[model samples]
Target: MTVVHVLLGLGWWLVAPRGAQGVPRPFLSLHPSREVTLGDTVTLRCRVPHPNVPVSIYEEDGEPKWQWDRVEDTAEVSVNVVTRDFAGRYRCQYNMTALSRFLRVSNPVELVVLDPNFPPPVMSLSPGGRVKPGTDVTVSCWSTYGATFLLHKAGISAPIQRQSLSRGNTATFTLYGVTQSDVGTYGCSYHPRGNPFVSSHPRSEVTLELEEGGPSMDHPVSQQPAPRPSLSLHPSEEVALGDNVTFRCHVPRKGVRVIVYKEGDGNYRWQQDGVQDTTEVSMQASTNEISGRYRCRYEILAPTWATDWSDPVEMVVLDASFPPPTLSLSPRGHVETGTNVTICCRSPHGATFVLYKAGTSDPIQRIVTGNTVAFTLHGVTQADTGTYGCSYRPQENPFISSPIGTSMTIPWHRDTFP
Candidate 1:
């Protein structure tokens, strides 16, 4: 009796044959291996060596899958389209006929079928996609860029494999094994690192079919060209202070993920769901961050693909006066009568500056300059001992002004007769 069993772990487990070294066994094998995605065409090759014999293929003992009469050497079984039910361990045998003295049974090979609810990833085999039984096989998963990845196989609940992302600007994962458990559909997905909740909308799927009898096989990852998404500010060019504004991202096609960006030193991001064609994001133009350049891009889930950044859409924020104008008096302490007291106002981004006295709606004076503005009260007197304030209009925008910068004053009385 041949000893065959396995130790289970993260990798797939399969029963190994006990055939002696240098001993040849008529074991089942697959060509290009049977791993296939849903809707893919696959061919399972069965090899029956010389002396002219009939061959029989089965899913397991006493469960025949197919048979061939007096076949020469090789037989090809074609699966038009793969489905989940097609997944199983298969074996092939030969010569139950009178022309041959012995009936030989081959080892089993699992036909693992995978169907992707999302998009399937391109798989590649290292050192080649095929390997003999007992030898290691490397199944590398490749796509544009994905963060964390997961590997799945037929009938298993939890992920059969997991791989963290590698930097150097690459999104690939590698699974190592050559066992029956490894035979099935394999898929992966990615999200921005640190974000475990939101994964890419589409998954990357791959199916790896194991060969029966002799060796094993796998494939190399595939790469595709990335797409580019366009972005714009609604009301395109500029936004007014305190006005409702929007940032819209547009992709060439629908069903893709679009990310909108504003140049921020430290910005937390937001996501929008069910994006049909364009992503519309709106916010009030209240902060200094309102005006600047913005752009957009997109990503494809299944393919693990991304597009280049769209052309930048510059935004001009109207009136960005938060830390309002600074109002200062030259004779800051106590102003003596018959001396000039200069009130100066300045704000980094303000376009116009105005000086206002308390209890008056009319500005004492207004100046048109993005820089400093000064108004001098000549020969300060008791009448000019009122509160003074300064304000500014930013970027020449309508209805946008800085908060009032107020200054208190008390003029020292200089008596004509002491």
Candidate 2:
């Protein structure tokens, strides 16, 4: 019986036809590799040596695992619009009775479905008009098509707030602490996975104005007679160099000849003179020596009596050549994983400063310092390690300095000593 069993085993190995060898050919091929969007389809087919053999189709890593075996001459499988999870490689094999053979592994067909939607949703501020400073305002965003909306504020680059889809075709954004600087345009858009191919138009703009004390509309009219005769310097107020300074005065509306005088010891330096009813003049001062209080007055022709000088507006000019501000990292040295740190900037003169991570195009943070000139980071992490610097523009034209300061690296992990 042992000899007979040995003979049978030998027969099985020798007589059973060898499994198909070499590379099997693919009938159809997909060009790109895997990574398709949420709504795409793909097809795969295998080449058959002889026509009319049962060919079964199967998909690896697909939901529901396997589809019913397709017994056509050439097997073809189709995947409908895909989602994030649908990204993967797929191949087919031919099943032979003796042994199964793999056809050429089709080139990884990658499908990337973009949002396809351009220009996001439209957002409108209601009353659909401008809001007065310090007043509450409501912003609304609506999509002609899908839901899901993101709202971005003017001046603020990032999306300050977001809203989920509600019943109707619209979503509303509201601002309680509205200010005059927030008086620009706003935008909104939608992000949808399904049919992610549509976007809405941007809505109109809204303007906001600031009113000191109470609304400027409520101020009582001045009863005293206007007085302005001679030009004199107002008390000089100190100002950082590179800052925009405006000189203002009150001149009679009609029949008044106005001449601006810069206060200088002994002889008053006369500057430009004009007949137009001008109240304010602006100029960039280069140094502290140019600083002084300035006042203005007007006369009607030679013999006419000049009015009392208007209130003096002080101006003080500081040095303009200081180096650009420096950015400093708190807790100096390596940053441990998950540890927090602060990045601070100190500049004598700058309107706005933006902080960017090395190699990145967008700013990590931005600070608009009308008066205060510093940027503070709340929490620092390992990712915060890199070069840092800033660019600044003086109040007026001429030159905007190049980026100032050097770069610093922060390491997240520390080496342990044995």
Q: Identify the candidate with maximal TM-score.
A: 1
RMSD per candidate (Å) reads: 36.6, 26.9
Per-residue lDDT tens digits of candidate 2, residues 1-418? 0000001112222222243344354443442323233465655555555444445433322312332243446665666754444433344444433332222222223233333333455556665454445464677766666454655556544344444443566766654434433444566666442322222334234454444543334222112324544332223243556566655555556655664444222132333445665545565555544454345556444333334334544453534364556656566654443334555565566544555554544444444444234433322222233455554533331123323455555443332100
Model 1 lDDT tens row, 229-306: 777777745455778888888787778766665432115234554577898889887775555546666655453334
Q: TM-score of predicted model 1?
A: 0.27
lDDT of 2: 0.43
Model 1 spans > 4 angstroms off:
1-23, 96-101, 118-418
